[model samples]
Target chain A: MRIPLGRKIVTYFLLSTAALLVFMPTLMAVVMSFMTNQDIMTGSFPSAFSLDNYRRAFEQFSLMHYVINSLFVSIIIMIGQLVLSSLAAYAFVFLEFKGRDFLFYLFIATMMVPFEASIIPNFHTIRDLGWIDQYTGLTVPFFAMAFGTFLLRQNFKQIPKELREASQIAGMGEVKFYLTVVLPVAKTSLITLGVYGFLTSWNMYLWPLLATTNDSVRTVQIGLRQLQSQEQMNDWGMIMSGAVIVIIPTLILLFLGQKKLQRGLTEGALK
Target chain B: MTEAAATLSQEDYILFEQTKRKHRYKQFIKGMLFLLPSIVLFSVFLFYPLLRTIYLSFFLTDASGAPTVFIGWDNFVTLFQSSIFQQSIKSTFLFVLYTVPLTIVVSLFLAIIANEKLRGIGFFRTIFSSGMGISVAAASVFWLYLFHPTIGFLNIILDTFRLEKISWLTDPSWALIAISVTTIWMNIGFTFLILLGGLQSMDKYLYESADVDGAGYFYKLRRITIPMLSPTLFFVVTVTIINAFQTFGQVDILTQGGPQNATNFIVYSIYREAFTNYQFGSASAQAIILFIIILIMTIIQFKLGERKVHYQ
Candidate 1:
């Protein structure tokens, strides 16, 4: 079962090279974030490391505020999707009624309508309700999710029917059984869905751009845009620093939830 | 219950039927209740906006986005004739064509190589799929610096090779390619992870049988691995193309559809039309067009997937 040493060496060389190539963009940004503008211009390595770029990124650009706002909005959207989608998915899996398939497809059909395709009207509706520059505008519209519901429904379907029948025989209400028995059975997939929701919301760029106009409500993605515009050419270090800052939390989450993320993404896409 | 029902009289059977009908009614209400929260949100957000989009696409709208006059098919007419909209459509399709295939091929290569059992394969796997953690704006900015005209690392490398330096994002000809390179890189992480997962889950017995048959590596790959990986490959292509179609953040941050609208993709065009130009009617028409294209693409994908994929 063991591979030969020659093949192993070739595999290692190819993989490391590919990994470095794949990671080069990020690696360069991290490296240059510490370099001085002069050093960057001169194509030389950093003479001395400095926090000046990080300092300017926070002070001159107000990236700190954006970090907080993005976290708040993403967290709300994440929790909202998990609670709402899980409830809807529970109904789809456990409850049988007239027009069940019809309603389920009706929900699934929303996934076909790209938000970009329907964004103009949604913006109008949000503006009419005076939600522009508000967190509600950012978070509320994403609460209902067809994709999450479908994912959880798949997970729930894998649970044995005997469990539900036995719970019923034991005089357990559907609601109680769903919370205590059903949710726990699919806990890994649920967490996977939650992490997926969080990643999607965290990486959201288009909606937040239209939804918020002020620094108080802007996400870090928007903040990065502003920083680039304000300091386009002269401050490469600061811009790279700002980019790094925006990526920190997501990186942390990825490191913590790598397995769940792989599971969630593959399942969500293939299914 | 079956034995008891066999002994039941005709009147009792009628009573049982009535009780079953009542139970269905009760279950229906309970199901609706569980679904109520999502339904309410979807109705207000997704369903209503969709209808409004269709309605407004048929009308001329004011700057505030309210319908001012009913114009039957005029918006679509204008959209078809406008050079800019036409260019946007072309750019979008080209972007899809440019990014999807390259993303799949390269990701599959990495997945195949990384699938080998090595001491530090786990580390390589993580590094290979690290782009999934990067946000679009951040990734765009990183690429922007590397694409900087005056002092970019890519151009620096080119300079060392005694080659002419190229403008990464300035020239119209190179800008879309630049954005495409960025996109292909960004897509690598997700696609690689999915492909790697698929590769890992394949049965070793298939490969062993190929070995027992004295098949060479490339032959086994051609006959067994690719066929087994077709499902994941199909899924990856569908999602990658969809992502390419809806590309926005990178375009906005990198080029802003600049250098003569070479990168003015459909989604960005819709944004400019509605929010900037206040042409909701035209934007809605464009959105509807995008929707139809996606709907058709999705249908084609599903059809091909069902018909062509090999399953074990």
Candidate 2:
């Protein structure tokens, strides 16, 4: 559908204006991250940009340490969710046992129990496990996801039945079939689950705050909190730099998987 | 001789049925093996905590969260009478009210506009959805900077317009609204993406038919687009409302449930009651309340969503 010239101009005008409004806050943060404290205090766009804030953030806040911890935890949780959820989804779909639907629904029902409902006991569970300030504490509870399993199951269900029959006919065991056939065929779905897992884990705030007291186990989100809450934390430039660092990895992931990730994430949520 | 053959066949049939039953049982075991990890984790984290939170709500607990006394809803009574809890309840509902509809309407507008098949549309789509990339901590820090009492960009803008600067975070009147603005900005990314995906996946043939009938832009939007998009809209609204109720990270960072507790939503209240104050019983009660509110809202939305909203 081709638009008239005036309409096209108006469309572009509206789109650009809306985009700028949406991006304005982050854009300000990005712009301010390079400026000195004086520029930010005066609310001026500076003529000179400096890496001083980035350097100070790393030195004083130990921001890089938190970045690594966030990476380690997020990736570990992603792997755990991928493996465990895929296994459960494989059983739910490929096994075809009696009461399968019953079990699947039972599993999916847990999605209703938001973390707020369960955070108390889970905190004690971690503390009791002596996992406080441990990577395991930060990563383990999130390994089993009702939503991830459901997403994977939805995709796994789409695998052709004929493929399963062919595998069995070829004397391929179910375990081997899931490994070589089912998982590989559902590759896109797996990436979707993986990206979703990574993003959620990376952005987690409360649990990480509760689970880790020390910088040794703190993720980037908690790191930002600690940095912001520090006494005399008035260096807006440095704090903005830390904020920029925390978001870069996920943004990179989103950009790389832009077109596909949208569809993937939407399918994961909607299905 | 024929009778003997019939008896032998019946014995063989019984033997075959027994083996088949044994094989089916083995498959069940295998499936359970696949599911065992998740089941164990859920039992440990989700199921146990959910039940424990409910159970703990009725009983007073000492420090370390050990139940010391069974209060029989006295904790709830205290919460009802408590002025702070009342404020939190008010703040939470108001927070949802301030955030959800505005977020939905704004993002829906952006999604529809971004859906236009125009030049450089991908750039606009990326800009609109980039909020999905930002973390709560990062976004809050940015907001904190912007909401600073002095030398904040927002204040700078206000000064430029010759309007007196409002205390964005400290003033009770404006704190929740400021935080709500942050929440709305944070939400636009995911809501827009989902809504845009929904808009794009719609069958183009409907639009084609509308074109043939000489339907104008507003006519097609009103008669065709909105109704067709209702399911996605319903889904977005449900999720957004649930998220609004669970507003925590921003509140914790921005106000710490402060400035007269104007921004202390229920989740933050629960966090303080349990973690900071060690009043596990009160916190558990609050948790259960939050859960029920979300559950009821979800059920109501689904009920309405089932019969009315979703045009499916």
Candidate 3:
């Protein structure tokens, strides 16, 4: 059952090539970030690496403010989606109410409708609410998500029904039972949802671009876009530095939460 | 005594029915309370916008984004007749065609290779899946560096080989292809993860049985692995197509749908129509048309997948 040595070699070669192709861009970005602007334009490796690009990126571009804006928006979205989706999921799973099935379908149906279809009206809604260029405009509309609710509901339904009945019989209120038992049991799914929500909000480009016009509220993705336009001709190193800064947080989150992110993505697909 | 007992049973039944109705009301109240926040947000953001898009598509709007007059079918007609709109449609489909199948084929190959049990496999898997963490904007910047005509890494490589440098993003012929390369690279990590998960979860017995029957590697792959992997393949294809259709960020950052509008994706067109030109009605029409295209394409995929996908 042993494969030939030649075949193994080919397999390794291909896998290694694919892996390098995937990782090379980010690595090049990092490499270019350390080089001088002259070195980058000349396509030369840095003789002496410096943090000048990073310094210029922050000082000149106000990269810190955009990072803070992105962090604030993503964190709020993560917390909002987790809390709201879990509550709705709990009701969908544990409570008995008329039109429950119909309501669940309605929520799920929203997943199919592309966000582009709604961007204009949602913009108008925000403008009317006088939330333009505000934190609320950037984060509030994304607080409720059908995907998070669906993921949590599927997990919640797997919890035994008798546990809920037992809690009720012991004179425990629904809120108390949910807080004590359900939340703890569904922790993994919640973490998965949180990571997914955070990444999506953090990487959001079009909506944030439309919503925020200035540096006061623009997210990191928009900041990158601005950097590209503002420094149109030169300063490759500084712009790559900006790219590195924008990507660093997401990479850290991915490395730290790889298991949960993978699980979140593949969970419903298998079913 | 028997008649009195029957009367008591009936009275108890009535009391039980009253309590059940009251409990139902309470449960309904609690459910609505739990759902109230989500409902309000969804109604304001998702549902209302969807309906409004349709409604606005039928009107002619002013420069201020307010509806000025009722223009029935005018916007749709104008877009349908416009050559740029037509080109956008062609380009959108071409984008999907360029990205989807290649993503599936290449990622599946990588997944199969990475699926092998070897030393340092986890490191390789992480490298293969690392693109998942890179956002569209960051990835676009990296690619913009690589595809720059005079001072690009790719052209540098071409120079070493004594070959002519290609104008990747600036040339109309190469613009879409360059954007497609970036998207394909960006998508590889996601599609690889999904396919690798599928490969890991496959039943090993089928491969063993095929070996016992004296089947060659290609035969086993064709007969066993492909059929067994259809469900995952179906899922990957659907997601890749949908994502390809909605491609915006890379196009915006890299090409600005330029080089003679070679990379003018439908979403970018929609964005320009609304924001840049202040033609909200036209943008709404374009968005609706894109939605319809995506919807029909998805339905067609589902219909085709229903017959081919294998289920355990």
The lDDT values for all models are: 0.89, 0.89, 0.89
- Global Cα RMSD, each model: 3.0, 1.5, 2.0
Candidate 1, residue A203: Cα displacement in angstroms equals: 0.7
Runs of candidate 1 with Cα error greater than 4 angstroms are: B1-18, B307-310
- Expressed as tens digits, the lDDT of each residue in A67-182 for candidate 2 is 99999999999999999999999998888677888888778678678898789989999999999999999999999988888788888999999999998999999889999998
Stretches of candidate 3 above 4 Å error?
A1-8, B1-11, B298-310
Task: Estimate the lDDT of model 1.
Answer: 0.89
Candidate closest to the true structure, highest DockQ:
2
Regarding TM-score, does 1 or 2 come out ahead? 2
TM-score of chain B of each: 0.93, 0.96, 0.94
**Candidate 1 all-Cα RMSD:** 3.0
Tens-place lDDT digits, model 3, residues B174-253 = 99999999999999988998888888778989889888899997898789888888888888889899899899999999
DockQ of each: 0.80, 0.81, 0.72
What would the C-alpha RMSD of candidate 2 be, to one decimal place? 1.5
Deviation from truth (RMSD, Å), model 3: 2.0
